[model samples]
Target: MPNAIPTTELYLIAMAIIFCVPYLIWRLGRTDYFAPLVVVQIVTGILLGPGVLGAIFPDYYQFVFTKDVIQSLNGLAWWAVMLFVWLAGIELDLGEAWKQRRESAVTAGMALGMPLVFGSLAALALIQFPGWIGEKAQSWQFVLGIGMAAAVTALPILVLLMEKMDILRTPLGQRILRYASLDDIAIWAVLAVVVMDWARLERQAIFIAAFVPACFLFRRFMTRLPERDRWYIALIWLAVVSFGADWCGLHYMVGAFLAGVVMDHHWFDRDKLDTLRHNVLLVMMPVFFLSTGLRTSWEVGGAVVFLAAGFLLAMQILGKQAGVHLAGRLLGWKRGEASVIGWLLQTKALIEIIFATVLLDKGIITSATFTALLLMALASTMLTVPIVTPKLQRMRELISRDA
Candidate 1:
């Protein structure tokens, strides 16, 4: 016992391995086409977690991922996700969505509604089997939570993907962003409904009542502060809002998003905000992914987890494509437009994971269900570039040929 590595040393060693292994795999394997570095990191996390590597190497897993080390990692993961989610909220450009409200509403609604319906049906199937429903969830909660998870557009990741594809500055990409922005607001609002605690209704109501005035005053106050001072104040505000939401049983992540959503993006420099988001992902989000992987379970068996993942992924892709195609027809979109739009909307990486994390924390979904959704998210994201790139290329060739 005296010869054992100290907790601090082990924690540092674990962090080193967490970053190094995934970087090496991503670099050496050259999986940027199907599995990006972030996806590789998430898979590595699952492998390092109790289900995979821990199953094979019990002593090493126990030693490195000790209760203390995990606690340390979790604290890092918590703040990392909060910062990421907060940035996501601030990035939501509803003003643009409003300018294109007619098209945005129709596309966003069908895109969200169809997948939600499909995912809910899948949820219904899962609930009939044991180990799928959470201990505290009612039937409605579990169904709606899973449905919304399917409907998530992962606006941040979509932005990243569009940037890589060189379409981010194009008119089509801007249009896609408008539709996604509307869905982003709807996603979190529905989540608020799904996670609502009737027992704490009085407290939640009070929090909402207080938050409106506080938000207004906070915005006014922030506008009066110098830029440097504003950043510091924002962190303080993030903490206060997160605490209030958690206290009212709505959860801290919801509050974090709300905190950022109400604040004007112009309050900070756009370049600085972008850099901060990039740095957070580079430095801290891997920790969140690892912590998430640690929560994965196979009590219902690994095969079942994978099967459920495949089913949900299929439903998500098909349903989203169906919905977007329907919208395309209704809105008189040209051919090939819907395919590109559908694939882009299907990119659900970080947001879906965050949403599922909240659901798991609230006991609205069990670990087995969370694992399935995690796998579904990873698979869904991996498919985006490969599927969309060809569609985009073919469309370009067709246009050029016709010209």
Candidate 2:
């Protein structure tokens, strides 16, 4: 036993696999056109996870991903995800959404609503079968959790995709951002409802009651600090708020998002903030992807899981397109414009995975459910650029449309 490799070495080995595998696939396979590096990392995480690697080579999987190594990785993944969610929160631009309230509200509402309905129906079907609902989850919780997962739009991923297509700064990109930003807020709001625990009602009440005044003071304090100090203080605030939320059973991620929402983006240099986000993704988020992959399971049967994913993917794509196309008819969008926007908005990469992780952590969804959702997210994201590029080509003017 004493001659065994140290846990530290094993952990480093796991880290090396997590980073190297995805980069090699993404670079050599040249999947950036269809699956960006981030998407490749996510898929790599799944392939490296227990269901694939562990099933194929049980001893090797266990040797590298020892309990200790996984624990260490989870610790890092927790902070990595919290920081990523925090950045997403800060990037929300409600002010611009307000300027185009009518159009934004209609589009965001329908876009979110249709998917919620379709996904909830899918969840209902899932729960009718065995192995989908979690033990601790109420019927309502499972339904709503899956529903919101389908409805979510990954704003940060959308930004990256749009930038790659040279539309991030264009008027069309700005409009899509506004719609997605609004939906982002709604996604968390619905999540708070899903995670609501009557047993912890008093604790959640206290957290909310305290959080408001604390946010006010935190904002005031942040305004007084110089840029250098503000960065340090913000991290401290994220930890404190996240702890409070988790302590009250609302989940630390809910706290992380709220921690970012109250702070003005102007507090930090935009370039510096962007760099931090990139660096976090570069250095830490791969661990999160791997950690997420580790959670994937086929206990319900692999075929069943894939079937569920396929059904959910159809619901997601159909729901999103139907909703946006309806909005286009109402608002007089040009021909094929809704197709471009609908496809763009349907890009769910990191955020949906994060949402599914929270559900699994809270026992609202089984690992089978999580695996299906993960597959659905991966498919949806990979389909975005390939499908949208041609649509954009056919309707170039839509790219320049401001309203």
Candidate 3:
């Protein structure tokens, strides 16, 4: 035992690997043009996962990701992701979407609806094969779950990319946020449906019934608290609600999003909120990314997974483009505007991964299906900046357009 490397040391080594590998590749390779640091981190995670690194270097993988070390990493990953999801919910700008109700409704509806339909069709085809569907999943659950994953837009990553491109505060940026905000709500609601446990129906009903009053009370209490106290109290609310949701078999993430959605973003200073998000991504999210990557598998064969990913990617891209273009025509949008919106709206990186994780956790999809969804997400996100940059360059006026 004296010759043993302590679990603490192993954990630190794992953390070091988690942060260093992605950072160096991103910095040295200058991949920010096509792949941002976040995307690189995600890809690095897949490389470090059991399917890749473990397959190549089983001893090293086992040493660094021993059960104890993985548990520690997973603990951090859960909390980090909860905070990230909470922030996304807090930043939802429903008021703006309402103000532009007619246009936002038409655009957000088509943007979300089309991919959903197409992706559902893809899912139906996927379920025709063995090893793609989860053991406990119903046919409907698997299809809807996969469909929803395809339609997801990673709002946080979208914000980061837009900020990097210097369009975050522009009129065009706000318009896109409005559309994404509406779609975000729909995505989670659909997830709640997909994960619903009939056996826990009573518990779920009770949770919802109590949550309404609790949300009202929490909002009232939050308004009276000082900003510093509000921050601390918000974390408490996040833990309580997330626990309650999980206890009711609805999943903790559903609670986390609800926790943030009820709380007003105006309670915290915008600058500080932005800083917290950046800090969380800087210090904690890589762990989440790494843990997520660890869940990837190729039990169904690597070729099959990639082909599935390719099919899902094509469906996602085509569906999103068709939806946005249809809306653009109906709304009388300027030429090329729908193309920019379509490509941007299709960036699925984090949220899609999160959705797939939920589906996998709930036994609605197999690990192979999860791997395919993850690849589809990475490809969609990486395509965003590269494709959108030139379009924006050509249509410089689109950046300033309010509608």
**Alpha carbon deviation, residue 358, candidate 1 (Å):** 0.6
What TM-score do all the candidates reach, one by one?
0.98, 0.98, 0.98
Clashes of each: 0, 0, 0
lDDT of 3: 0.93
Residues 144-244, candidate 3, lDDT per residue (tens digit)? Answer: 98888888999999999898889989988999999999999999999999998889999999999999999999999999999999999999999999998
Best-performing candidate as measured by TM-score: 1
Q: Which runs in model 1 stand beyond 4 Å of their true positions?
A: 1-3
Q: Which of candidates 1 and 2 reaches a greater lDDT? A: 2
- The true-versus-predicted C-alpha distance at residue 173 of model 2, in Å, is 0.1
Model 2 spans > 4 angstroms off = 1-3, 397-403
Residue by residue across 194-257, what tens digits does model 2's lDDT show?
A: 8877799999999999999999999999999999999999999999999998999888999999
The residue-by-residue lDDT of candidate 1 on 1-403, one tens digit each, is 5428898998998899899999999999999988888889889988888999889999889988888899999999999999999999988888888888899999999999999999999999999999999999999999999998999999988998999899999999999999888888999999999998889999999999999999989999999999999999999999999999999989899999999999888999999999999999899999999999999999999999999999999998888999999999999997899999999999998999999999999999999999999999999999999999999999889889889
Give residue 58's error in model 3 in angstroms: 0.6
| Positional deviation of residue 356's Cα in model 2 after best superposition, in angstroms | 0.5
